[model samples]
Target chain A: MSLLSRKIADAVSAHPQKGALTVDDDRYEICLELRSADPEIGVSFDGLDFRALDASPRSVETLKAWGERLASRLTYLMEPLVVLEVDRIGTEVELRSAKPSVRESQLRYYELRLESSGAAHLRRVLFDRDTRTRSTVPCTLGAEALERLVEDFTATAA
Target chain B: MRKIESDQNRFRQIVRGKIKSDLRKYITHGEMIGKTGGELVSIPLPQIQIPEFRYGQKNGGGVGQGPGDVGTPIGRSGEGDEPGAAGDAPGQHLLEVELTLDELAEILGEGLALPRIQPKGRANIIEEKDKYTGIRQTGPESLRHFKRTYKKALRRQIASNTYNRNDPIVIPIREDKLYRSWNPIPLPHSNAVVLYLMDVSGSMTDDQKEIVRIEAFWIDTWLRSQYDGVTTRYIIHDAVAREVDQHTFYHTRESGGTRISSAYQLANKIIDAEHPPIDWNIYVLHFSDGDNWGEDNRQCVSLLRDEILPKSNLFGYGQVESPYGSGEFFRELEEAFEDVPNLALSEIRNKDGIFDSIKEFLGRGR
Candidate 1:
């Protein structure tokens, strides 16, 4: 569903942890900035005022209306830029064509990013969603280790 | 018979699809592991159920119609002459399917598109084992041949001129006993060892360790596929590090300061004592939340450069992004070892990035 920009603001305000939250599929690139409490993440994507989403009572309803149209309009078939942002901690997921490569549906490039908290939540969702596709791949180290911030990424051995 | 075989094959295909659809839950959820045993695993699949006849008399006219159907209730034949047992509940059934580990692995490979590992290093420790294969007069009683022992006893009794045709009873002394024997030959096999080093300081959380655990299992699976014999070692570290079993590796939590060097020292010690670079193909994978005591960061780099790198075939370092982590360790490694050939470093920002991280680290076939 298309919350477009407002859902992200609601997700961020609900939790101060950039890594702990993100609007599902709301994508971003978190630039690393040196800070006092370890390193903090700064996001790059649509800017929706965080204050307004919390203040407006009709935010969810408005988001639903806008998202429905947007979901229909934004076609992945055209090689659209897919940016996924999760409001759990902070993770920016972007899938796009790598440079100089011509656009072909099957040959397009893909990139994924997960802020720690956001990724942990995403794992629960994605791993659950993995039920839909029925993947044939073994959950091997290289593929699994590639997963982000999963606290129990090492669970099977346990 | 051919039709039945074809139907069974189609049923198996359906079961495979069901498994593939839920593969992620199966991977992430750990319930399936308990079900694994021997070479085959049983997975329960929900299926539709139907009732059928259990007894004879389909052709017998008087079987259900009470003697020749003349006064029988033939009016409601469309409704089925017999009054069946009534039940309101819908039929539900679960089908259990057995699959081998290799079959499971094949499905996994197809789903993930993982590259096969190319084994490296010189594995020269040839081993020889003997197995009981033939009957012999001299051998341990544990391997005694029952049929041969009886035959030899009977033959000895006859040879000693104590045989009787009417009372066919033959019993011989201990010398007539025969046992099984064995032959030994060298069997060459390749083996490997994986050393998993994890930084478990305050910066790292349980969530992060879970990720490491999942990744490690897959890593082990692929490596095991490459070599017949494989061993795994686990090391977890805080400001101080220690070598522990796999269980302790994921569960232990410490919160003082971070010293990446401690884990390396312990790993180096393990390699020196148990595995030699000449004998085993060693793969070292280090997962950290990317926080190291500033002064000790340099020490960690020194340890990797001087001690760890030389003894390992692939030295993989993954920086797990965390809220409480400094995240500068990855940058430091990038700056320090920009062109190191065997050094594989990756930045894991979240779970989705795991896919690419694995590709980048193992893509070179190390």
Candidate 2:
């Protein structure tokens, strides 16, 4: 295992939400967002509120190794998600997901806006198929909020 | 415009994905070499499906809005129709997409998880360059700024109250012309030179040459992306070594015996005369069948230890497997200099081995 993978695994294992919370019939996915300066790790449940945590790097090699490891982790995490979206913020990896209720016809997408100070804000939106209209949804839902939203949306949409 | 840009970006992403997925196949094949241009390579991708509005058959189809007789020909048949076995599958269409060498290198690095090369020994050289800094009033017509000249003419006409709303034409006079001016600026640029030495002895078959050619193309692509200016020199050796053009480097066949020291000697001379160790990042890559004169092995090792390895950023030895040649050179190099930092060695047994050979040669990020 590379240093970056070790660090990411350590961070994920030490997080308060580690294996303790489940939302939308899936476990919370942990991600490490890398940057050229002052890199951080982020964790999200439903592609929102990617909480950034602090990290330290020994050199550029560690950063590059971290990126490769993070990509592998993201690929593994995406295997079970209904919708997977991967983007980059500078040198960082931004992963977003949606519940299975949001079908492909809904044209769902997510974006993360990273400020200069290294804070990230995630937004998710879906388009209506019949009306050709777009509507934004609050993506920063916690475990309880995500569970309720997924249950309600699944029940109502079905 | 935004929609078109978004579509273009999406298409580029799809192309990248296709290239990444078939990277190993591409590394082993030399089809893209013929399509390469100065800084861009055209890759033929057969798997990318072009999206189009495929029309379906209309219900109750008739020529004149009425039902036609069954088994009746409505249109004339072409003359080329002949009795042959039918193919139920749709024909495949290949799309040739142009990608800059930088983009290709990025994909190679990401796909192989290759580390970024940290250039050693005076990575940068300062060169004077001309930059178009600002506009001037008098210069050659080739340097004339059309938009600036038109704007100047318009401003002059408006200031003199000679603007015509009817014609709406502002002709620029000599005084209103603007020309681009340049200034000499000193720029630091990273320059690299690749020394490609290949064994073209009787034992090295055409298949081995083809493998060397394919691997060289990809290595050149990746290295060229890292440096500002990359110069490639080709040397083909049997018993005697001689410099050759890129075309002759891969196609030539020699009947003489093998002597690895000749190529190294010529490479050393070339570096000492032209590419000095203090000014350029040098990469020395040699492809052979791991066969050499029994006595020359010690000379080759001594030359590498004394002259080549110290001056080179990387010294890569790729032993292409051949049935006619005894593969002993790689074992000698490994036994002598296995722990060297800049020396990278790999055994390429066939086309499939080119992928791993590339990884071994460039994995260290030298």
Candidate 3:
């Protein structure tokens, strides 16, 4: 258990409903909101931000995994999130997903939103070129699934 | 007058033909929903020119009689040079023609080639029609038979030797009054009741609701043309189900989990209470994104197979595609009710699929 991982696990235990914790000398910020019965984690890295969706109460292991993975690849993970923020101007955001399987004549992308409280929201976007319409839907991705998505997205964006 | 009526009928046929040709576009775009007023809808048809004499503007100058010189520009220069401004020219506007629900239904049936529905059970509505059966000598002035009373008065005058050839004016007195008497004849009418159940959960978007609205409008129109009396009921559900008006059914949105069986249970209760199978032809049309709770999907299947399907003349389930909804319930229904005769299922991907979905439901003609 490193110092950073212990800090994250402590934050998770302290703010079961709604709270925020900043660590790594103000390099990262994590906000928790559990009013919808599902824990939503909003992560801010430096100035760029994205949401880590589908965090469960039993996510201490997931938090430790994130700590180790995020320590080295924080810049790599943010490339896609930054691109998503630029792409999602003047469009509706529904929900977040890591892997988006688009159909024919469809364009799939991601969107990021930075809240006033330093929390960030990441949403999956599916745009149909034929109809010129965009849609997003809530996708259930547990903490483990989100870790895998982060790994996959960073590798793909790289 | 007969010739004028025949011309009007011809004009109406042409209008119907124009509407039928554009029916698919109208169904997909849903432009007619906003123009609906009560039992009539105003359809905008282009290129149907009505022949009429165009009167010139009062006191308007002729082409060469304007104030400008022969080579000078007409009126003020740069008058219409503004960018993106409304043009002053007489544009060809869409001619809005009002058609009754019955007429629109006929057009839809003809356009889709939908078979006429055979109403089930007994005639539920017994309407009383006032039929003139006899004549009475004394009654109220509203029902007085003018010609008969005049003839009676003329006969009385001639019988009493008071009618003159030069000035033959027949006066109808109280004794000569004849009144029409009528009996209330009971007319048997086959009726139907349509139960519209919609999933208004968070997964169901405004676009999906609009698609459902367009489809429902067409369905309502078609069914109304089939039966003498058609009563419509709307049920909206997320986690819980409740009955609402037509406006609320298409507009309401609730952020909750989906339990499709709740809507089915409410529909069953409504059917069992008001519309008995023995007396009325019942139709259950449910629109959802097919995102039911894992356990509730089974409950929905069982409820449909046991209660709703058996009582309904036709059971139509339209699964509208949504990115959020898992759409597992549609597959469940397909696996469960694959061979069910009255059950009609359709997958509406978007607005373009409404035309085919309507055909799939009404084509059964149950």
TM-score of each: 0.52, 0.55, 0.61
RMSD of each: 18.3, 30.4, 13.1
The Cα error of candidate 1 at residue B69, in Å, is 28
Q: Which regions of candidate 3 fall more than 4 Å away from where they truly are? A: A1-158, B52-86, B129-181, B185-190
For candidate 2, what is the DockQ-based docking class?
incorrect
lDDT (Cα, 0-100) at B326 in candidate 1: 29
Candidate 1 vs 2: which has more TM-score: 2
Write the residue-wise lDDT of candidate 3 on A57-98 in tens digits: 323233223323433343333223221111111121222223
Model 3: per-residue Cα lDDT at residue B33: 82
* Ten contiguous residues minimizing lDDT sum, candidate 3 chain B: B321-330
Candidate 1 RMSD computed on C-alpha atoms after optimal superposition onto the true structure: 18.3
Task: Give a tens-digit lDDT track for model 2, residues B98-164.
Answer: 9998999999999999888877655655688999999999999999999999998999999999999
DockQ value for model 1: 0.02
Order by DockQ, highest first: 3, 1, 2
Q: Candidate 3 on B1-366: residue-level lDDT in tens?
A: 697899889989999999899889988978788888998899888879885656679846756664756788666877978688678899888898999989999899999999988776775457899999999997899999998999999999999999998999888888999999999998756478999999887667788998899999899889888888789999999878999998899899885557788899999999999889888899999999886654778888889989999899999999997643336677788888877889999988888999999999999988
lDDT of the candidates, in the order given: 0.57, 0.69, 0.70
Best model number under TM-score: 3
Would you list the clashing residue pairs of candidate 2? none
Ranking by lDDT: 3, 2, 1
